[model samples]
Structures are given as structure tokens and as C-alpha cells.
Target: MSTLTFRSVSLRYPPRAARAGVGEKLVLDGIDLQVASHELVAIIGRSGSGKTSLLNLAAGFLEPTAGTITVDGVPIEGPSADRAVVFQDDALYPWLDARDNIALPFKLKGVPLAERRARAEQLLARVGLADAGDRRIWELSGGMRQRVGIARALAAEPRFLLLDEPLGALDALTRTRMQEFLLRIKAESGAGALLITHSIEEALLLGTRIVVLSPNPGRLTAEIEAGFNAEVLNGASVAAVKASPIFKRMHAGLTGLIHASAEEEIAA
Candidate 1:
């Protein structure tokens, strides 16, 4: 089932006092989270809340300073193909076209050139970039680049997908479109995802469960079940959701919580 487990996890960045005159930073404080198979969980927090660090740990891009993390009952020591990450920057090679970018993973895995090309073409179509396969990254828009990134990530058929603010840089309209596209891709691929984002609207629209992290020594503050319907998320129903009494209440609560935490940090 590819379950992910985090047992009393913590992360500390060593003191850079010689340069910054600050003490060692405690980034994550004893976090314990589990993401079950096929679950799409969103982690939301203000800037500098260590949300990215947490995602890095899950992806094995960074080891936890303490405790253990396991994927599918296997201890994670480093990066592996079983987990794929889609970052905020898209990170596509400027020189490579969409097809070549998507084919990089297969090329690295030593898949035959013809097979890689075929798979890349298929994934580009899947990600709505079928006509963009031959277009270089520079020729594509920001949202299109990210679509290519998503296609590249899918090339591995990863069991776990980690997204770090993958749509944060896009324009509002484009972000909304990408959100619906992501939902469709998730449904089609059936890959479990852990998304780190700051947008409450995005979380509410996309997450199966939303986990909010408190600021400074970031840790889980609240976990809310998100029962967003695919149809509602993809249609004009978003306006209705925003107008719903429950939505207004929760949005106010979360926004207040975020600001209150920031104020507390300032006061401290």
C-alpha cells in the first residue's frame, strides 16, 4: 500500500553563529505524521515554517535530524525512484523541449531511446502538453513548464509524489486551472501525494486532508478533513464553496490562526 510513517521526526540546522550570530535553528520539532496509501494530504503554513523541510524529509532529499521515516514499511535513507518530487520552479532544462525533459528520467534509468521517446510522448499527452512536446522550455509559459515538470515526475510511475508549492508561482487563473488538472492527474495515476502550499483555497480545493503547521519550530497545529468533490473543484461550484457558511467560518479561523501565530512570533 506504500504507507509513509514519520516517528518523532525532528530537524535542526546547525548554528551559523560565526556568520549570522544566531544560535542553531530548530526547524522541525518532533513531528509525527503518517500518510496512508493513496491519500492526498496538504501541509499549509506561513513562510519560514519549515514546511519545505518536512517535504524534503519525506522525499529523502534530507534526512531527519532524529527519529525515523519509512515508506511502504521500508526505512528511507536517501532519494529513490519510488518517491518523485515536483518543485515550485518547474526546473525544466531550458535547452530541452518538453519531450526531452520528460524523457530524462527514462534516459537515466537506461530505457531504450525509442521507448523513452514513446513514453515521453504519452506523458506529454496525459499532461495536456501533447502539442508542446517539441517546444523548448523557454518557448512555453510558466504554467506550461510546470505541466512538463509534472509529466517528468510521472515518468517514474512513483508511488509517492511530493509537491512543494508547485503552483505558488502561477497567476491566479492559471493556478486554478492547474489545480483542476492536478486533481485529474492524481485520479488517473492513483499516486499518493503530499503537497506543501500556503494557499488555504488551494488546500481546501485539493487536499483529502489538510494539516496546518504552526510557525517558528514548525509543527502540526490542526488537521481538517477535506471532503471536496471533484465536480465542485473543477466547476463554478468554487464560488458556492466560498459562499458557504462553513467555508467562511473555516477560512476565517485558519487565517486568524496564521496571523495570530505570526503576531506571537513578533511578540516573542
Candidate 2:
């Protein structure tokens, strides 16, 4: 199995000239994390906790100020097809239909037209959008659009998925359904995932391991092992798994942990 590792990683942005006498702002500090193939690691924390920063580092969109990030021991230099990212906004091209959008990655790689088209069709089916391949991006619902985005990401055949609040934009009912869909896709695709979310319930429901980051220079503060995702994959209903006592307890504990961190930050 492949492993994505962040070793003592930290990020600091230079102080703006306008902020006279202010030192550099530290965003993340001493972060050590690993996401292995087929494992979903969910990251949860309050705003300003650098959850998105962590995801960006993994995506190679931003470099850390210290330490290193690697996939199977090779240092990451910049964004590559090996790590696919799905954002809250679908980011689909309005000019292209769903199928063509998914095929865009392959097209970039110089894959022939016929091959890319065939592969795009397969991904459409995988994401349960088999008949929506011809649909216009503007015509699809928010959930449908996100599915297309995910399919496009999978087109890269990446080793890891960096999901940045992919479901945060959806309505309550759709978000609930998408949670189950995500678990299924994670299992079927066999790609490790690093999900940055604000929802404690989401972290508990989907994560094989939930990691918490404390703010004001985000640091890994807690890690909790969870099996709810595996339970769903094993044929248990999402509702059933969520309603269990252990699930509720963990959710409460995580909520308290995050709230306490926020309170402590305020008191300081």
C-alpha cells in the first residue's frame, strides 16, 4: 500500500509590509500525518486552524516552510496527477458536457480521443451519473455537479484524494446521502483520502481516523480511530451506524475537544 507522509511540517507566511513590527504568521506547526492507500483520514478543527492549509500542502499547491511531505518516501515538489483534489465548488467547465469534462485530464495527458471518451463513460457510471454524461454543467444540480467533479478527479488515477469540504455546499439531505456515497467511492476507488471538514459528525461518520488540529498555529492535538466508514462498507446503513452509542459518544467527545480548544484560544 502507498503512504502519504507529512513529517514535522510547518507553514509560515511572511508578515505583510503593512503590518509593521509584526513577525511572520505561522499557519501550521510540527504536523506529522500519514494516509495510506484505502484509508480515509478526516481532519477537523475550528476556523483558522489551518485545515485547508494542510490539504493544500498535500496537494502541493503550497509548500511548507519547514520539514517535508512525501508519497512513499519521495518528496513532493508540486501538484501532480498522483494526487487529485476535489473542492467545495465543482469547478466544472460550463462550456463542456460532463463526459468531456471528465475526459479533460486524459486529454491533457495526450490520450487518444476514443480512449478518453471510453474511460470517461466508465467513470460516469462509477459515480452513478451514467445517463448524465451529456448533461450541461449548468443544468445539473449541486450534488450532480460535485459527482462529476469527483469523477474528473478519479480520472487522474491518483494515489490520494484531497477533499476540501466537498459536501459543505450541499443541502442537509443531499449532504447526508453524499456522505454514504463518499464512503462507497473511497472503497471502490481504493484511494487514500485526506478530508478537511468543519463537521464533527462528518469526521466521525467517514474517517477511518479523525485528526484534530488546534488553532493559532495549527498543531495536531488529537487522533481518534473510528470504524463507522468500515461499517458502512460492510453493508451497515449510515443511519444505523450513526445512531449507535459509540458513534454518539465519539461525536460528543470530538465536539467537546474542538470547543475546548476554541475556548482556550479565546481565554488566552
Candidate 3:
């Protein structure tokens, strides 16, 4: 199994030229995180807690000011097919249909057209978009577009998925449905997932492990093991698992924890 590791990672940004005399701002500090091929780790925090920064670091869009990020012990040099990212905007190419969008990755690698088309078809089916391959990006629903985006990511055969609030833009009912879809897709893809979400419930429901960060130079403040995802994956319905007493208790506790952290930050 592959593992993505972040050790004592920190990120800081210098003040913009327009902000004269302002000191550099620290975004993340001393972060240590890991995600294995078999795990989905959800990270939660309030605004300015560096949640997106952390994901960006893992994606190699930005290097840490200090510390290292590695996959299977080798430092990440830059973005690679080893880690695929999904954004909230469902970043699909409108000019192309879903199939061609997914096939674009293969085309870049110079794969034969027929082979790429076949692989793209397989991925569309995998994401439950079997008949939507020819659908235009603008013609699909928000959820459908997101599925296509995910299918495109999987076409890269990445060892890890870096999700930056991929479902945050969907409507409530759609978001709920997509949550389950994410669980199933993550399992089927066999790629470790690092999800950044603002919803404590989302983190609890989907994460094998939930990590909380405290703001003002974000730091890891809490890590909780969650079994709700496993229960749902093991045949318990999402509604049933969510309605259970344990699930309710954990959700409430996580809510309190995040609120308390924010309060503390404000008081400081």
C-alpha cells in the first residue's frame, strides 16, 4: 500500500508589494499528516485555518516553507499523476464532451486514440456515468459534472486523491447523494483520499479518520477515528448510520470542538 506523508510541514507567504511593511503571514505550522491507500482522511477547520493550503501543499502547487511531503518516502517534487485533485468547481473542459475530457489525460501521454477512448468509457462507467459520456459539460447537472471530473482524475490512475471541497457547491440533497458516491468511488478506485471540508458531519460520515485544525497559523489540534463510513460501506444505509446515537454524539462533539477552537482563537 502507498502512503502520503507530511512531516512538520509549514507554509508562509510574504506580504504582497501592495501591503507595504507588513510581515510575512504564516499559514500552516508544524503539520504532520498521513494517508494510506486504504484510508480517507478528512480535514476540517474554520476559515483561515489553512485547510486549502494543506491540500495545495499535498498537490505540490505550493512547497512548504519548512518540512517535507512525501509519497512512499520520496519527497514530492511537483504535481504528478500520483496525486489527482478535484475542486469544488468541477473543473471540466466545456469545449469537450465528458469522454474526451477524461481521454485528455491519455492523449497528453500520447496513448493511442482507440485505447484512450476505451479507457475513458470504462472510467465513465466506473463513476456511474456510463451513458453520459457524450454529454456536454454545460448540459450535465452539478453532480453529474462532478462525477465526470472525478472520472477524469481517476483516468490518471493516481495513488492519491486530493479533494478540495468537491461537493461544497452542490445543493443539500445533491451533496448528500454525492457524499455516498464519494465513499463508493474512493473504495472502488483504491486511491487514498485527503478531503478538505467545512462540514463536520461530512468529515465524520466519510472519513476513516477526521483531523481538525486550529486557526491562526493552522496546527493539528485533534484527530478522531470514525467508523460511520465503514458502517455505511458495510451495508448500513446512510440515513441509518447518521441516525444512530453514536453518530449523533460524535457529530455534536465535533461541532463543539470546532466552535470552541474558533472561540479560543477569537479570544486570543
Write down the TM-score of every candidate.
0.92, 0.96, 0.96
1-268: candidate 2 lDDT, tens digit per residue: 8999999999886525357536778999999999999789999999999999999999999998889999999999999998999998988999999999999999999999999999999999999999998999999999999999999999999999999999999999999899999889988888999999999999999999999999998999999999999888889988898899999999999999998888889999
Query: By TM-score, how accurate is candidate 2?
Result: 0.96
Candidate 3: regions farther than 4 A off: 15-21
Where does candidate 2 stray beyond 4 Å?
A: 14-23
Taken over the whole model, the C-alpha lDDT of each candidate is 0.85, 0.93, 0.93
- Candidate 1: tens digits of C-alpha lDDT, residues 108-171: 9999999999999999999988888899789999899889998899898888888889999999
For candidate 3, the TM-score is 0.96
Worst 10 residues of 1 by lDDT: 14-23
lDDT of 3 by residue, 158-231 (tens): 99999999999999999988999999999989999999999988999999999999899899999999999998
TM-score, prediction 1: 0.92
C-alpha RMSD of candidate 2 = 1.6
